[model samples]
Target: MEFTFLFSQFMSGLTYGLMLFLVASGLSLIFGVMNILNFAHATLWLIGAYICFTFWSLMEAHQFALWVSIPLAALATAATGWVCEVVLIKRIYKRELHEQLLITYAMALIFGDLIKIVWGPTDRLIVRPSIIQKPLFLFGAPIDSYFIFVILIGVAVAVGLWWFLKYTKYGHIVKAAVYSREMVGALGIPIPKIYTWVFTLGIFIAGLAGGVQSAIGSVTLGMDMNIIIQAFCVVVIGGFGSLMGTLVGSLIVGEVFSFAILYWPDGAMVLIFVITAMILIVKPWGLFGTPLRA
Candidate 1:
């Protein structure tokens, strides 16, 4: 491949990686705090896309509409997540992982059906904002403005979350919980409330990811399945629930998929799995993950 081709491929990889990071970060946060696999996470993302599209369609078409719709999408998904937690998930906090997974898996079906019932099975695309439809030159290659925004947004979120987790009182409590859940509960920290906050925060991030997704393409029913598999791969490779690991793992998986598609399209899907398996064999806890002691 020519140098220019390789450079373009790298850029593509970076963009895709950033997208994966946003989605995976939410998954990691939820798992890290709650020890539950949220089957409805990806569905929530797709819901955000539809919500954003609908909101934008209702408003006067302009930059203002774009700005308004994006936050609405995020907030709407967050609300759904909050409801899901309060109504069903809260009761399962002490259940085994497999049982939790079963409940959530059922929710995934319920969510998909709800989407179909509400939005129908038809494919719907969002209109990209004028601000994001243009392509800007990056290293002499034309990069889509929407992809650039995705990358910037991912970076901003990573930084903001890092600061929040590292500097806040909640962060300290979370840190304690991570090490010893029983002890933290004993210490008089409202464990249930903390879990609620953490889970809601995770859902909010997932919703934000979905909102960003809307700008790139139409919201479709299949997106939930598509993104969930990728997000799982990211979490596994990054070490079940590690934030920094999610970031690094996302970049690796994204770039690998991008470059593989450019060089050998057939192997693209299997490549991430292959690499993840190798990483787990060598370092089961992942690059940034810490194995818990019995």
Candidate 2:
């Protein structure tokens, strides 16, 4: 019984960790490549969830509601991201960090308000589609099939990203731009275009996170702020702009939250900060983070 209980917790933690990784990876990628700390990221996620819910509700009679809603919601969020990058973010690249933060933070507020206007004050949820609604028995335990699907999606995303970065030409350009934007530009590459792409990619991933999250819980007003804190912590502790670090940090935060909630319900949220502080005390730059420019 003890072993089975532990296994259940482990699976739960792993499922949640994949979602965290999905969200954190985008933030890390944006920060590493474009040096933008996008405060609007979680807002994009919230919008995604709301959009997914809306779409699913509209198409509830459809047999493939989940499949239809997810991509549509993600595309909507990506369009929002594209507009932000092309219009607002493009103009602010040379601004101070505080200025960038303030603008993005304000955008987050705007998105929150927009969501309220559209979805109202009610908490929304997207039910797991009937296709994956049944529980799968594993190790004498019934596990949610949707959770398993989410985990598999996360793994696929990770592997896809790795392959894209390693084998694709644009990926190579992005990497070069990361290390030396000036050099890449000097070599006739359009660095601004790259930044736009990076921003789009970042928020697109955030949107996907939101779409996935719709299956797990309520899409409430403050959901943006809720995940943003942990996303920031994950990136900071795992090393800013490090994809693998985001994965590691997500696992740490997710598992810590899972176990801590089991052991000390009140401290579940607090323990993540405790772990972040400990990691920073030892390696101030984060486990895999490169030194930042002063």
Candidate 3:
């Protein structure tokens, strides 16, 4: 019985960690390729959730509403990300770091307000499909069926991203840009266009994460604020631009938080910070990240 309980907790932590990976992977990719820190990333994610909810609500009578809405929300959010990159982010490429930070931070506030205007203050809930409505037993442990789906999606995404980064031409370009954007530009690659597509791809992943999250719980205002901080932590711990690092860091955080809550509920967050602090002290560049060029 005790083993079963522990297994369930471990599974829960894994689920949470993968969810963090989904959000943080895009964040890491953008920062790695463009050297841009996007404060509005989570807000865009929230928009994706709301968009999914709206789409699902429109076709609530159909059992297939949710399956269709998730991808649609992702595409819509990707479009928004593309526009923001071209209109606002493009102007800041050569600006000072402080200027870039200020712009992205302001965008976050603006996007947050836009969300309120469009979705109002009411919390939105997704009516899950009948297929995932019940619990599944695994070795005498009852697990949420939806969680199994979440786990599978997370694993699939992780594997898919790894394959893309390892085998594709654009992936090689992205990797090279990460090491030295100047070199990539010198090679005649359009840096600005690459930046735009990378940003859009990052936002698309975030949107997919958001759409998945909406089915997990009620989508409420200010949720982005919470997740964004954690997402940053994930990037920092995993090492910005290192996909495997992000995955490892996310699992560490998720597992620590899950188990810590059971033993020390009030200190779970503090414990996470403590661990993060330790990692930063030992390796400023993060566990998997290489030092930045001077």
Candidate 4:
């Protein structure tokens, strides 16, 4: 019985960690490729959740409402990301670091307000489709069926990204651009265009994660605040631009938080920070990250 209980907790932690990976992977990708820290990424994710809710609400009578809404929300969010990149982010590419940070931070505030105005103060909930409405038992442990789906999505995204980076021409360009944007530009690649697409792609993943999250529970205002901080921690721990590191870091955080909550509910968050601090002290650039060039 005790083993079963522990297994359940482990599964819960794994689910939470994969969710973090979904959010942080895009974040890491954007920062790795563009050197831009997007303060509004989580806001964009929330926007995706809201968009999915809207779409699902519109077709609530149908069985396929949610399945269709997720991708639509992702595309819509990607479009918004593209607009931000073209109109605002593009202008800041060569600006001072503080200037870039200020603009993204401002964007976060603006987007947050927009979410309130559009969605109102009401919390949105997505009713699970009949298929995932019940729990599944694994070795005497009951697990939410939806959680399995989330895990699959996380794994798929990870493998898809790996294949893209390892096998595709554009992926190679993206990787090269990460190390030497100027050199890639000199070789005739359109650096600005790459930046635009990469930013859009990152937000698209965030949006997809959001859509998935909407089905997990109520979508409320200010939800992004909590997740954004954690997402940043995931990126920092995993090392920016390292997909494998992001996966491992997310699991570490998720499991640590899950188990810690059982033993020390009040200190769960503090413990996470303590671990982060230790990692930073030992390796300033992170476990998988290379040192920045002078």
Candidate 5:
């Protein structure tokens, strides 16, 4: 019984961590590559969740597969991200920091309202594929299949992202741009175009996370603000602009909440801050974060 409980907690923490990584990676990458701190990230997440629900419903009506809705949702949210960049974010590059903050906050409110208007003020549940409804056993310990599905998605996204950022030419360019956009621009690279692409990637990641996660529970109001705060916590604790840091931070925060709640349900969430403080005291920039440059 003890072993089963421990294993279950570990698996639960792992899935939660992976999902946090999916969300935090985008926040980190956007800051790393574009130097823009997006305030509407959670708004994007909620929108993606609704989009996922809508597409799945439409597809199910046509007798299509459930998994197809995930990509469609991702694509839709990615497109929305692009539109936002062109219409809103791009115009504010030279604005004051407070201006950016206000604009993003307003955008969040707008998106949040839009979600309520479309989906109504009720909880929505997604119908996952039939295969994921059962639990699987590994070494006599039963693990939920949906957890496995989420874990697989996390692994694939992590591996794919690593490969893209490490081996591809565009990846190197993104790195170079992150360090010094001026240098890249002087070398005849179009920085504006790169900015669009980077923002698109970040938003796409959030959408994918939302679509995958909505399968596990209800998609409802205030989810955007709730998860975004946690996502920001992951980014802040891990170090701004570091994907590896985001991953590590997500694991720390995720596990802290998962295991802590078992022992003290009311106090579990506070551990996230306590552990983050401990990490910050030792490595102020984060576990894998680089020191700031002039």
Candidate 6:
């Protein structure tokens, strides 16, 4: 590919990577602290998009829709997570990994179909804000303002997470609990409540990610499936429980798929899996994960 072509591809890759990070961060967080594989995570994103579309359609202005849908979507996703935790995931924490995976996968299928029942099988689009519809020049290339927003939001989330983990008291508590759950519980910390909050927060992030994505393109019923597989690849490549790993893995996968499609349209999906398989063989715990702990 020519330099210009490669540059544009790289920019596209960055946008894709940021979107993946938005989804993967929530997955990583829940898995990191709770030790559960949440299959319904991507469905939450789809739910958020649908919720955004519903609100946007009801209220015609892009600004009004954007303002209302984000928090509403987040709240809806959080409530769903809380209910799922109470009704299902919490009970299966001590079960086999395969069992938890099976249950969550079932939940994903159920939730996805439920969304279809509510929103129908058609795709729905969000009206992008006027400001985001304009392109910004970067390095002699025009970039979508919406993509810039994704990158900025992702970076801000990363920084905020880092700061929360490093400086906040509750964050330290969570870290302690992650390392020594028994000891943290013994010290009078409400581990159950903490798990609930963490789980809810993760689901909310997934919802926010989806709501944001609605602005870029149409939200289809099957978008969850498309995103979940890539999110899973990111989780695997980054390791199940590592935040930084998720971020890096997302970028790698995003770039690989973007460039692969540019050169070999049919092989794009396979390339990342091939790379991930090779990496797992070399370093099973992922690039940033702690092998023994995870």
lDDT of candidate 3 at residue 242, scale 0 to 100: 98
Question: Candidates' TM-scores?
Answer: 0.95, 0.97, 0.97, 0.98, 0.96, 0.94
CA lDDT of each prediction against the hidden true structure = 0.84, 0.86, 0.91, 0.92, 0.85, 0.84
Clashing pairs in 6: none
Off by over 4 Å in 3: none
Which parts of model 5 have CA positions greater than 4 angstroms off? Answer: 61-64
TM-score of model 5 (CA atoms):
0.96
Off by over 4 Å in 6: none
Number of colliding residue pairs in model 2: 0
lDDT of 1 at 257: 95
Q: Where in model 2 is the C-alpha error above 4 Å?
A: none
**Cα-based lDDT at residue 160, candidate 1:** 80
lDDT by residue for model 2 over 1-294, one digit each (tens)? 387787778788888888888888988888888888888898899899988998899988787997888888888899999999999999998999999989898998898899989989988877776878788878977777888888988898888777877899998898787788889999998889999998898888888888888988778899778688988888878999677788888988888888888999998888899889999999887888888854
For residue 86, model 5's alpha carbon misses the true position, in angstroms, by 0.4
**What's the best-to-worst order under lDDT?**
4, 3, 2, 5, 6, 1
Q: For candidate 5, lDDT tens digit of each residue in 128-170?
A: 6778777888656788888988899888888888888899988
Error of 5 at 55 (Å): 0.8
**Candidate 4 structure quality by residue, lDDT tens digits, 8-101:** 8998898889888988999999999999999999999999999999999999998899999999999999999999999999999999899999
lDDT of 1 by residue, 1-294 (tens): 667667767877887888888888888888887888888888888888888878888885676786788888899989998888888999999888789999999988998898899989888776765766777777777777777778888899899888888899998888778778899999899998888888888888888888888877767888889778888888888887678899999999999999888778998988888998899899888878888533
